[model samples]
Target: MSASKKARAAARLSAVQALYQFDMEGTLMATLLDEFHRHRLGMEIDEEKFEKADVAFFDDIVKGAVARREEIDAVLSQKLASGWSLERLDKTMLQILRAGAYELMARADVPTGAVITEYVDVAHAFFEEREAKFVNGVLDAVAKSVR
Candidate 1:
């Protein structure tokens, strides 16, 4: 991958992780962003080095997703099938959806296909192929509506 491509992929991964942290820990957005900036981005953990992320893009995604969460969730809820709701989704899946939804709705510069593909890649990092497919389907539905 080119440097920008790698940075964006890393940003997507980090944004999902940040969103997961926000949901699970109830950490404030500002605090979480600061923590990631100060400690996590491009840092090594357990002897594994993280990719150098696009800090500005990472900030935009996390902030945008959090700022517009209710709207994003409503759109996501609609895309879900009967008897399934956002609350029923796994936490990681939920974050992935939210991040993808935020991008589809707000990041006009990014192609819709790119958003879906990136989040599916993010899902693959934490989940089985089935979950990645689920992310792909939900994100495709979300992109259709928002893009």
Candidate 2:
């Protein structure tokens, strides 16, 4: 991948992780973002060095997703099948969905396909192919509604 593309992908991954952390820890967004920028991005952990990420893109995704979470969740909830609510989703999957929906709704510069693919890839990082496919399907539905 090109440097910028790789950076954005890494940013997406980081955003998902950060969102997961925020959900689990109840950490303030500013504080979590600062910690990620200063200590997490590109840092070595578990003997695996992190990829360099686009700081601005990372910030935009995390901040935008959190800022518009309720709106984003409402949209996601609508796209879900009957009897399937946002609360029923796995927390990690919910974060990925929220991030993808935020990008689709707010970042016009990113193509819809790219937004869906990136979040699917992020889901694969944490889950099996089943969850990745779920991310793809949900984001596709969300893109149709919002993009």
Candidate 3:
């Protein structure tokens, strides 16, 4: 990826982390976003590249994820096994789904392939090859279903 794309990926990862924190901690949306801005030195991947524009982009992704969460989860839940609910998925994987689904649903400017590729890259950063493949498969299914 180009430098700006890499920067955007990092920003998305940070947004996912923030969302995961909120999911686990029950932090208010406004408070969590404020905390994210306030603690940039600690939470950010690259302080030098952080800008107001990136912050706004991250906010857009997070807000979009929250707004379309139920629809996204329903799409995901359909792909799960008989006993599994969306909440039963791994936290990191759920974050990936929410982030990917948000891009798929809300960002008309970003091609579906680009969105899936970016989130798969994000998954690969932390998961093993097999898990990344699983994420890729799930996201592929989600893109097709939601389209």
Candidate 4:
């Protein structure tokens, strides 16, 4: 991957984690952004070195997802299986969808394919292939509607 591509991938990964923390812990937006910028992005944790992320992209995804959560969630909720509500989703899975949905709805500069693929990769980090494919399916649906 090119440097920008790698950085953006890292940003998407970090943005999902940040959004997950926000969802589960109710961390305030400023606090969430601060924590990620200060301690997580590109920071070594447990001796595992994180790649340098695109800070602006990271901020946009994390901030945008949270800022427009209701809109994003509405789009996501519609794309879910008929009986599966957002609340029924695993929290991490929800964050993946929210971030990906936000990107599709707002980041027109990012191709729909790339948005879906990146979040599918992010989903892979925390889930099995089934969940990753679920992410792909949901994000693809959302992209189709929005983009």
Write one digit per residue (lDDT tens) for candidate 1, span 75-110. 999999899999888998999999999999999999
Regions of candidate 3 where Cα sits further than 4 Å from its true position: 41-53, 81-83
lDDT of 4 by residue, 24-56 (tens): 899999998999999999999999999999999
Q: What's the CA error at residue 139 for candidate 4, in Å?
A: 0.6
CA error at residue 12 for candidate 2, angstroms: 0.5
Q: TM-score, each model?
A: 0.98, 0.97, 0.84, 0.98
After superposition, candidate 4 runs with Cα above 4 Å error: none
Cα error, candidate 1, residue 22 (Å): 0.8
lDDT of each: 0.94, 0.93, 0.78, 0.93
RMSD of each: 0.7, 0.8, 3.0, 0.7
Candidate 2: segments with Cα more than 4 A from true spot: none
Which 10-residue window of candidate 2 scores lowest in summed lDDT? 39-48
lDDT of 2 by residue, 74-139 (tens): 999999989999888899999999999999999999999999988888888999999999899999
Q: lDDT value for candidate 4?
A: 0.93
